[model samples]
Target: MKLNIAFFGSSLVSSYWNGAATYYRGIIRALAERGHTVTFYEPDAFDRQKHRDMEDPSWARVRVYQPTEEAALAQLKEAAKADIVVKASGVGVLDEWLEQAVLEYCGDSTTIFWDVDAPATLARVKENANDPFRELIPEYDMVLTYGGGNPVIDEYTKLGAQYCQPIYNALDPSTHHPVEPDSRFSSALLGFLGNRLPDREARVKEFFFKPAQQLHDKQFLLGGSGWEDVAQTIPNLDYAGHIYTRDHNAFNCSPLAVLNINRDSMAATGFSPPTRVFEAAGAAACLIMDYWQGVEQFLEPDTEVLVARNGDEVTAHLQNLSVERAKSIGQAARARVLAEHTYSHRAEQFEQIMKAERTSRAYV
Candidate 1:
């Protein structure tokens, strides 16, 4: 069946300040390729409209709307006519309002709460007992997350969700495969791509900054937004602010090894792997990631990817890095991602979930 999937998300055309753009594009495009119709509704807030890096995608219809009660209701009404109406987390602003409105307005359509930042959302709900979303969780037909494996599933189920599944970030080999390393970044021993968020600042300091301090002789390149105000006195660490998604391949290929640092909440929850992991691996970049509970389930540690607990471990990897071994690990990770983790794989899973939902509803 050709399903109509309406998505209320951050921004489909802009990755400027939105982290979910890549995930949204990959899955939606795959679904479209499979003959599904997708309509993405993004609020014209956060200056995202001004900094759109991409044109309206051919696979999905992108609609920008004003953030008003009337506008939201209109969008909700239109979306409710579709087979699936998804309200994704971090819609830039008014997330709580959107979540509640979707649950209330989605009439016969299958309502889905797609939590891109599952750890942060769970933490917020836990801290606020009276959070409106707590009661709304069970109302949605299904709860989907970008990452946070079993922990997220268990927590959502405990909170009264009938079904909670993680649509973990996966590699789109077409967009992220290996490219020739750019000379500008190839000399750097370590590369990290992350935006500076308050929740993640301390961990970044501990993992990226401290390690750079320990290994002053090695070059480290940090690429992302919101770091211009940060003082970079560390001699070996270079700040390449605000890397575009198109430049990811060059960034991944340039560094000898790429580092993946999970935010404090994500690390504490233990199953969340951000999009960077798959992107780096897809580009055949050797990945050294911080220790997380479910790291083994995704990539084998010390083989497909390296796990680091602290600055000492990170420094050790940098110092003892063998070119042949790193290359072998990168190749292995690429093979694993291409085989099991890709947008097409995710799209198939989503189709199964929808079919199963329809089957269950038919019996009822």
Candidate 2:
């Protein structure tokens, strides 16, 4: 049966400005490829004029919503007709009341809370013990996490969620693949592009900044927002500000090696590889990642990726590794991602999960 799904997510689908939109486009397109009808509902809070990437593809239908009660109610009415309703995490436009209202409109359709940031969400829930939504976990049919392995699932299940699963991040080969290296940023030792992670700042310093400082001959580039005022003793570290999503491959190619610093929550949860890992790998750039529990599961150490335990380890890799060896590792990682991790693979897993849910409901 062809399933009709209502996907409520943050940001305009047409404007692939953020990482969330990239995720949306990948999964939604994959779903469409599998013969599913997806109606994407996005709140127009951000400026649509500032779209930094490609326009919406022809596969999925998009619906824009307003903040008013009438607009939300109307969208809810339309959503009720779908076989499944997925309220993605971090729908920034909707207020708390609207989120609750959307959940309440589950009415015969399977309601899934697709949490993109499980660590942050879990952290918030833990901090707010009195939050009513904490208890609302059990009400949803299932809770889906973008990444975070067994630990995340166990935590969600313990928090009263009926079922929880990790979808995991994967590369979109169509968008990210072996690209011609950009010569401008090619001489840099390490390049990191990620938003502010307060808890993981230490890890960033240890694995990235410190190493760049130690190797004064090598340059380090930092991309993404919220680092203008952060104190940096390292004169070699260059801030690139925010790089657009479309230009990510060039940014990755510009650096001889890219640095991936997992947020503290993601590292603690385990098996949570961010989108940048796949993106960098897909771009065929050597990746130096901070040590994490499930690092081996996604990328093999020394073979597919270089594992950096501390600033010293990072510096050692930068100084010891030749450009030829780094390129070989990058190629291997790209091959691994192309074979095992992609949006198509994720879509297949999603179908299996939904099928299980439907079958179980039928028996009940």
- Assess candidate 1 and give its lDDT: 0.89
Report the C-alpha lDDT of model 2 over 89-206, residue by residue, as the tens digit.
8877664655577677766899988998898899888899987679778888899988888888988988999999998888888877767766656667789887665776888777
Task: State the lDDT of candidate 1 residue by residue for 1-364, as single tens digits.
Answer: 7899999999999888788888888899889999999999999998888888789989999888898778878888888889899999989767888988887888589999999999999988999999999999999999999888888999999999989999888888878899999987888889999988998888888878888888888889999888765636787878888888889899998889999999888899888878889999999999999998988878999889999998789889988898888898899999999999899999999999999999999999
Q: Each candidate's TM vs. the true structure? A: 0.97, 0.93
What stretches of model 2 exceed 4 Å from their correct place?
12-17, 46-49, 68-70, 231-234
Question: How high is the CA lDDT of each candidate model?
Answer: 0.89, 0.82
**Distance from true position, residue 53, model 2, in Å?**
1.7
Candidate 1 matches the true fold with a TM-score of 0.97
Model 2 pairs whose backbones collide = 185-254
